[model samples]
Target: MAGDSLFGIHGAALEVRAQRMGVLASNIANASTPGFKARDIDFKQALASLEGGQGGGIAAATKYRIPVQTSMDGNTVELSEEQTAFAENAIQYQSTLSFLNGRIGQITRALKGE
Candidate 1:
């Protein structure tokens, strides 16, 4: 209970989001690298599994992204798609952080009885 109370799903979410950002950033960085396959995290699936008591941490949620069009250089990372996913993940990360901060503030106020 102590562990859950201090962080809960938001903590896990932050970790996952950070990891996803890294994956997306790597894809963007290697967009021109031959045979580079894009990877992504299934956010909704990961959250659902965690919430349902299936504990695998963040690593279990990652998946390879399927490209709509394969390049002649054998690179699979789509720059535009990766950029979109990165931006979206960044927004979600910020939202989770804001939520965690609010939760912490609430707890602080409750402890002070004011």
Candidate 2:
């Protein structure tokens, strides 16, 4: 019952997104580095994996690769793209936090008979 406090899919989804955000940020930061094949976050695949509820096998929710063109220096991150991803991730995180807060408040009210 205690574990029920977690927002099931929402909580897990947000965590995965947050982790992805970190990876994307790192890639962007190292965009100027030589031979760096930019990393990406597989949000859709992650969500599918969560929904599929599969484990102990091939992980579908893996960030496969970046569709980067061949660069001599080998840096593939685009500033605009990374910024966009970061903005979107931030919004999603905030929205999830708001939702969890509301859920907790609802439970609190129920406990108080309010």
The numbered model that scores best in TM-score is 1
Candidate 2: Cα lDDT at 14: 72
- The candidate that wins on lDDT is 1
Per-candidate TM equals 0.85, 0.79
10 residues in a row with least lDDT, candidate 1: 50-59
How high is the CA lDDT of each candidate model?
0.86, 0.70
Error of 2 at 32 (Å): 1.1
Candidate 2, superposed: residue stretches over 4 Å from native: 1-6, 56-60, 64-70
lDDT of 2 by residue, 35-105 (tens): 77766667776665655665611245545356446457766777677788888988998898788889889
Steric clash count of candidate 2 = 0
- Give the RMSD in angstroms, all C-alphas superposed, for model 1: 2.1
